[model samples]
Structure formats: structure tokens, C-alpha cells
Target chain A: MTCKEAFQEISKYLDGELSEELKRALHEHVGRCAHCKVVFDTTVKTIELYCDGKLFPMPENIRNRLHDLLRRKFHERAV
Target chain B: MHYTSMMALEVNRLEKGTDRLTGKSMSAQPQKATERAESELIAEAKAGNGDAFEELVNRYERRIYRLALRLVGNTQDAEDVLQETFLKAFEHLPDFREDSRFYTWIVRIAVNEGLMKLRKRKSDRSEPIEDAVDDQGQVMPREFRDWKPNPEQLLSQEEMERVLLDAAHKLPASLRTVFMLRDVEELSTGETAEALGLTPGAVKARLFRARFQLREELSKVFKSEKSLDL
Candidate 1:
């Protein structure tokens, strides 16, 4: 796989969209090509940092307000 | 997403005692037992059990809140989206046909509410309304440096968040929403397409662009000191 071809496949490889044969070709290309390797590795890291769920925490006040609203609405419905 | 298949997967995942999005166990009850419990909760909630509905809310609030925050890019708006989503969910619970897991159904509501929140905010600012586009051209990587291993550990949580959110926000809303749903929320491409009213091909194309753009954006911050020597 050439660098350009490897570039196009990187995201698909990460997303598990590539077929096994193409995946191997891309993996081989990335293994030999330092640039593609960096791009591939960092892209994986990028997804991980977001998925870790530490970046956004629901603040206590917001959590309280949600429950409060739900409680109030449920009460009104009951009455 | 199909609830029956997801329920089967849930059974398997429950055996491992972890939630994929949150990485925490939702229930310690046995797999089949917990599956029935969730279905029961949904049924009871639909039947007018407020506490049952609350239990369902407690199960998914953090994830839905995170999705809202990413979609709208602020706490106040995210809070609105979160409250409104559950409000709508509770109001419409009776109409939900149980074809999907409660989480999947709630996610659909949150995404719509978040998008609506974005549209309303943009309109309030007199900006042209921009909905998600179906596709984006392929973006080539301009950066080739390796990020420091475990870059999250290098920065404080606040610093990390600022970095991640800043990069994410730089993408136009079109690609940002796709990335948030597919990559961060771990929704399947088809699920994302359904949520955004786009095609799977479009989801794939936009996701391709979004990942490339995000990797480039983050490379500026997390790149190691050594050059690649290429």
C-alpha cells in the first residue's frame, strides 16, 4: 500500500470497516511507514481521550435540577 | 440498534460486569436476571411507575448529559438538553413501542434535543441555520508526530478537557456531531445515520473526515519532543 492509500484506509481500519486482506495491507504499510504509524496511533488515542468520560462531568447542581424537575412533573401528573 | 440483539449483548457484557460507555457495572444481578429487570423497569415506567422511570433515568443520565454537552458545547445548554430530553422521554414513554433498548431510545431523544438547542442558539445569534451535511471530502493528515503515550495523564482533567473540547469544536458541527456519536458515544454507524437522518455512507465519509481533523488538531498539543526524522 502506498502512503496515500494507507492514509485513506486508516480511519476505516480503526472503525473496523476494512476487510481482513485490506487491513493486513494497511497494517503492513503502517508498520513500515513511520508517518502513517504516528497518524494511526494518535487517531486511536484521540478517540480514547474522548471516550474516557473524564472530560465532562455532570455538575451536582445540574443533576439536582434534573431530578427536581422530574419530581415536580411527576407530582403534577399524579395529582 | 435492535433491542433483542442488544439484550443478548447486554447479557454477555453483564457477565463481564462493565458498561462499555461508562466502564462501570450497571447491575450486579445475573445477566438474564438483570435483563428482565431492565425490561420490567421499562414496562412498569410505561405503566405509570414514577420510581421505575427514575431508575431508568439514573441508569443513563451521565451518558446523555455528556452527549448533550458535546453536541451544544456548553453546560447551561447541556443542562437544558438533559432536562428536556428526560421530560420528553417521560411524557412519551407510553408511546415508546419497546423496539429498542431504553438507552437507545433516550439517546435518540437527547440527540434531537441537543441539535434543536444548537439551532435555537444559532438563530438567537442571527447566524444561518446549518444542519448536518451528508458527506465531507477526505482530509489528508498534515501532522505526523507521535503523541506522548498516555497523554491524558500529562494534563490535569480540566486541561485535558479544554484540549479535547477545543479540538472537537473546531470541526464544523456537521463532522463534530458524527464524531461525538460514533467515536465518543460508541454508537454504530447505522445508529448514527438514523439519529442524524443521514446515510451510512455519509456517516462513514464524515467520520473519516472528523477523525482526520481531530487527529490533526490534537497532534499540535500531544506531539512528542522528538522529530519523526522522516
Candidate 2:
């Protein structure tokens, strides 16, 4: 892919929005362009690293309060 | 400006997974949570069953809270947004259509609430706000380099997690929200666009900038470690 074409379609490529023909062209470009290849590879890995993150536990205090508030609302709505 | 810009060209064609319906993404190595059994609870809750609804809150509270924290950049504000978001969702339940998954629907609500909080906080500031990044027609071209010694080779997973979290918090509200939704939460570009009320192209553009900035942060961490090894 021309560097110009790469920048324009990189987001679409990541988002899986590219057509088969375009994907082939981009892949061809990256296969030859060392810089784009590294940038593309690392970008994929970086997103994977973050996506690997676990959801942190909510504080017990807030969880309890949310329960209380929601129960209260549910009851208030029921009545 | 002679800024050194780094581009992350991750073309994970064969490796990545996407939820066909919602476009939710999962890591290549780990399977994400399976489709939640929310239909039963949603039905009961919609009919005014308090206990049933409480169970629903317990299920998604943490996910919503994390999304809020990333968007608003603080615990207190995130908690506030979380509380308001659920209340808003519950109040509007009678109007709910089962077109989308329950988590997707709630997440859309939470995004709205979180962004509202960001806007209010910005207004409360003494200084007039300026664009976080002035938009020029094109992203400036910069020298590209490989992030060698790879993430797995350079740092422990926990170390990577800690530094990435901190760096994520540093992104501006607009960028952070898009990043958290599209990348962190794995929402499809269309879902993200709908939540933020932007076009799909806008979501893609914001996501591009977010990924660019975040890649820069990752480079800094690895570069610093390289020096420490010297």
C-alpha cells in the first residue's frame, strides 16, 4: 500500500471494514514496506495488550449503595 | 512542528475476533465473556420486579463503572455517572426495545452520562477550553520504527497493564471516550458511533488518533526500560 493509502485505510483495516480487494492491496503494500509492517504489527499487539486488561472490581461501598438505591427505586416504582 | 510521530500498523487479519452482531472485539489470546443471559432478567425487571432488576445491576455495574472511569478520568465522577446511568436506564425501560443486547444498550446510556459529566467539568474550569488537538487536514508524516523486543519480551503483563492504564487516563476526554469504547470495550465502530452520536467515519478518525497517541506512550515505556538496562 502507498504510505498515503495506508494512513487512510488503517482504521478501516483494524475495524475490519475493508473490502477483500482493498485488503489485498494493503497487505501487498505492508509486505514490501518495512516501516508500515512494524507499525501495523506493533499497533495490533498494543491494542491486544490493553484489551487483555481485566475489569477492576467496584468498591464494596459503592456496590452496596447502588444496591440500596436501586432496591429503593424498584420499591418506589412498584407502589 | 518537528514532533516525532509513531504509527502502529497492526493488521491482525487472521488473528483477531469480532462479534458479528455488535462488532465487539476480543483479544487473540483470551476468549471474552460469552453472551450474557440477560433476557430473563430484563423481562422481569421491565415488569417492575425489584429483586430481578437488582440482579441486573450487579451483573453490569463493574463494566459500566470502568467505562465511566475511563471517560471521566476519576472515581467519584465515574461513580456518579454510574448511579445516574442505571437510574436513567431503569426509568426508560418501559420504552426499551430488545433490538440490541442488554449490555450494549446500557453501555450506550453510560457513555452519554459520562460525556455529560466531562462537559460539565470542562465548563467549571476557569480557563476557556481549546481543542485538545487542533485539526489539520492531514496527520503529519513521521519516521516509522518497529517496537522491537516486543511487549512480551520487554515487560511483565502487569507492568504493561499499569503503564497503559496511566497513559490511557492522559488522553483527552473525546479521544479517551472513543478509545475506551472502540478499543478497550471492543465496541464496533458503528456501535461506538451510535453511542457518541458521531458518524462511523468520525469514530474511525478519533480511534486512529487515540491509537497513535497510545502507541507513542507504549514506545516511551519500552524506551525508558531499554535505558535502564544499560
Top candidate (DockQ): 1
Model 2 lDDT per residue over B17-92, tens place: 5432233554322332663457777898888877777777877788788777766656799889999989988999
Q: Pick the candidate with the highest lDDT.
A: 1
Q: TM-score (0 to 1) for chain A, all models?
A: 0.91, 0.71
On TM-score, the candidate that comes out on top is 1
Candidate 2 CAPRI-style tier: acceptable
lDDT of 1 at B141: 88
Per-residue alpha-carbon lDDT of candidate 1 for residues B1-230, written as tens digits (9 for 90 to 100): 44324323433442343444466754323355444487788899888889999988887888899888887778889999999999999999998887766676888899888878877787576432343453655478898878887787899998887788788877777788888877776677887887788899988998898888888999999999988987
lDDT tens per residue, model 1, A1-79: 9999998887776665678798668767776788987877677677767777556999989999999999999999999
> For every candidate, what is the interface RMSD in angstroms?
7.6, 7.0
Instruction: Tell me the TM-score of model 2.
Output: 0.76
| Model 2 chain B poorest 10 in a row by lDDT | B1-10
User: In model 1, which residue pairs have backbone atoms overlapping below 3 Å?
Assistant: none
Superposition error at B19 for model 2 (Å): 11
Fraction of true contacts retained by every candidate, in order, equals 0.63, 0.44
